[model samples]
Target: MYAIGIDIGGTTIKVGLVDGGKIINSNRKPTASTPEEAVANIVLQIDALFEKYNLTVKDIVGIGIGCPGLISSEEGVVCHISTMKWHNFPIVSLLKKTYNTNIKVSNDANVAALGEAMFGAGEKFNNSIMLTLGTGVGGGIIIDNKIYAGAFSKGAELGHMVIRIGGEPCGCGRRGCLETYASATGLTRMTKSAMEQHPESEMWKFVDGDINKVDGRTSFECAKQGDAAANSVVDDFVMYLSEGIMNLANIFRPEAFIIGGGISAQGKYLTDKLTAYCEKYCYGYKNAPKSEIITATLGNDAGIIGAAALVI
Candidate 1:
């Protein structure tokens, strides 16, 4: 079966012709200022893809879209996306007028999790949780191979769960949320703090003594070179991240936790620590089967492939 997947972003929109888990053809273009213009662009791309592939829309199974912000998948509407200034847009209905096929819409993070569960790192697991550790932590929970977005599409905001009360302020008007300590932004903050305290740390050299230049990679990269300050930052980051993971592990007990986003680029350096920490501290760790911590395989394609899985 074939499906068309569209991943909508603030700057660009990615569209793909997917055959199962693989993207057979793809196109990307800058996002328009309005939803209607974006849809028109998608129509042009879809027509070109069908013609190039010698297939019609009727030959495909469906079209699926992965969009950011609160989405009502059942209603196929985008409730709100602050970055795009969209509110209550009936996207699926708009597309349905032109194509007679199954159509689905979902949160971008949810689709990325679905993509991973269906064909990426969590493909073998019936249940999985995906944590995207980028600027902020974004996550999606999957149970029995379906997204569990929870009531009113507001659940699964895993990044907001408070790991430490009164520790740090979060953008969501909460203190000590997991996003404050476990995200790339958090890692950068920790690195900056460490750099401030340790004037002799090699991390300063990595970024040419400019604290503003420090990023998520600063500490991890410096730690590999045996820098004490950097290693300390990495250890602290892993500790907070593992604490958050175990909290989810005890509650959901999913088959696996698929770790994605920029920090996941550390690969084994990150997962090995997360697994070890969870195994040592998670509830019933010794008495029950454990969830594996693995890196995401799809990378940027996860959103697109996951949207396809919504219909495939």
Candidate 2:
């Protein structure tokens, strides 16, 4: 049976039809302006796939969706997604009207983690943490081969984790949140700060006298090109990221730590830095799992793949 996995992101709605752990068909559409309209659009997209594959509802085992914001995955209800302009939407019921088939829904992060656990980087580990480094640091925790959705389906709010009590102000109306320093925007902020402090650093030269060019990639580029200022900013961000992960290691101690999303593409350089930094703060890394930190193998498809694999 083929399963359709859909990920509702703030900017786009991604869907995929999969079988045997591989996505054989997929498509994306701009996210709906309203919850109701969004569901309708998804149904239309699924119908297109159904026709293309020459299959009917009977051939589809299930449909799974993942979205940001608070939600009761067990209940298939969405609650207050500021980024998506959503509030109290009954996603499961809405989708049911269109398919009349079994459906599953979950927070985007959790489902993405599920995808990695079932088919991507965390497949080898029974216990794992999946981090999506994008506009912000999204995440999901899997334990005992099942997602730990917490008591209220709010298990993995990694970006909101407070690394500093009174650091940078976060859009979540909190101060010094980890997302402020560990995300893309965080890197930008750090770069600007670094430039202000070290006006003559090598990074400034690479940025072409434009602070706007000093983004995360620019910082990484400069660091790779041997820029001390950019390296310092990268080090500071990595230090904070590892510091936060240390607490995760001390508690979850998963079999593997899978870093997913765009930012994680930095590869071994990042994992090495994160590991070295985390180890310093870890209680005792000498005998710990050595925490084999690895990048996400599935990339952006983790959420969709995980959603499809939900029925597997």
Candidate 3:
């Protein structure tokens, strides 16, 4: 049987026809501003998929959705979504009423983790955690091949974990959250700060003195060129990132830590640094088998495949 997976993002909505861990067909559209409009647009895509494939509702098993923000997966309600400005929206109920099919909804990050565990880098392990380093740090945990969302379904807010007691301010109203230092946004901020402090650094030339052009890759690229300033930025980034990874390692001890997001594209350069740092500082490094640090394999399809796995 087949399933429909919908990955709802701040700017786009991805719909896919998935079967046996594969997305046979998919499409994308701009996200609507309102929940009603968003749901309507999704419905249009769902109908289009059915028509394009010449299939009926009976041929499909169910529909799964991965949405941003605080989601109550059991109740299928979105408690809050900062990016979409949605609160207490019963997304599953609305979709079910309109489509008359089984529906499941979950936090986008959690679903992405689930997707990875079921079909991507974590597929070989029964327990794993996925960390997506993007504009913000997103985390999801899998235990015994099942998603562990905690009692309130809000357990895995990994980025919010404080690495520094009083450092840079975070969007979550806290100080020194891991996201403030480990994400792509954090990397850019660090690179910009480094450039400001060292006008003689080559990083300024890479961005042509445009701090706005600095990105997650700037520090890494400059560091590769033997820029001391950029190397310092990368060193600090890896140190704090290792702290967070070690914390999670000691707590969950999952078989692997799957890294995703734009920064993950750095491939072995990123994984090697993370693995080295994790090994050097992770608890019981000498006596225990360390969790492998690896890159996520599914890339963008992880959300869609994972959303579909919710029903499979």
Candidate 4:
């Protein structure tokens, strides 16, 4: 049966009709000020899809929602969402009251991981982990083809894992969290710092001598061109990221490690390096099964598709 997926973001809500791991139709609507208004808008969007596709209420199996913030997936409650200023919101009950069908909810990151695991990069793997390397690092864990959000629906926060004690400060009020060094923002910081130390580095040419212009690509691109300082930055980034991956690998021993977000666009070069590093340093690397590192394929649609998979 068809399933409806809704991805709630700070500025917009993405709704989609999905079947057999494919998005049949989708729409985006401006976020509403209140949860009630948001649910009404979602229903309208779903109605539009139904009308366009000649589907009926009986045609849909369920609706799944992915929202940002601390979500209690088991309870179908959004415990807190800073972007929407929602707290202890009974999202599942609200949706279920309107539709006599399954209504599932989970943290957006975990939902995206589910989407990737079911239909994207982790399709063939029963166990997988997804790491999103954006402004800040985000992560999700999938075990046995299911999202593992932990007992309180607040687990799988891989980015906050401490790799270094008393190192870089993180927004989570922790020092040396993996995100402080492994995110795209972290990479840019590393690049800018390297350029400052090596005024003659070719990385400056890529960013036009403007440190503000430096991004995750600045170091990797320059390093590919044989820039010494850029190479140092890239190496450092790879090392830090690898450390995080290795830590997760040791704990979960997933069959695949899927990398997503902007930096993942680096593709094979980044995955290859990570795979090599993890294989060499991961505990019991030679004795235990190895997890393959790969890039996520779903892109922006991951959220919608993943959310749908919750009820699929």
TM-score of predicted structure 3: 0.97
| Candidate 2 global lDDT | 0.84
Candidate 2's error at 282, in angstroms? Answer: 1.1
TM-score of each: 0.98, 0.95, 0.97, 0.97
User: Which 10 consecutive residues of model 2 have the lowest summed lDDT?
Assistant: 283-292
Clashes of 4: 0
lDDT string for model 2 (87-204, tens) is 8899998888878888988888888898898888888888998877777888788998788988878767878889899999998899988888888888888888988998888877
Q: Ten residues in a row with the worst lDDT in model 1?
A: 151-160
lDDT of 3: 0.92
**Number of clashes in model 2?**
1
Q: Per-residue lDDT of 1-312 in model 3, one digit per residue for the tens?
A: 799999999989999999988999999999999999999999999999999999877889999999999999989999998877899999999998877778999889999999999999999999999999999999999999888989879889999999999988999999999999999999999989889999999999999888889999999988989999999999999898889999999999999999999989888887899899888778897688989999999999999999998888
CA lDDT scores, all candidates in order: 0.94, 0.84, 0.92, 0.92
Q: Count the backbone clashes (under 3 Å) in each candidate.
A: 0, 1, 0, 0
Which of 2 and 4 is ahead in TM-score? Answer: 4
Question: Which residue runs of candidate 4 sit more than 4 Å off their true CA positions?
Answer: none
- Kindly indicate the candidate among 2 and 4 with the higher lDDT: 4
Model 3 Cα displacement at 107 (Å)?
0.4
RMSD of 4: 1.1
lDDT string for model 1 (1-312, tens) is 999999999999999999989999899989999999999999988888999999988899999999998899989999999889999999999999999999999999899999999999999999999999999899999999999999877689899999999989998899999999999999999999999999999999999988999999999999999999999999999999999999999899999999999999999989998888888889999898999999999999998899999999
**Model 3 per-residue lDDT at 150:** 94
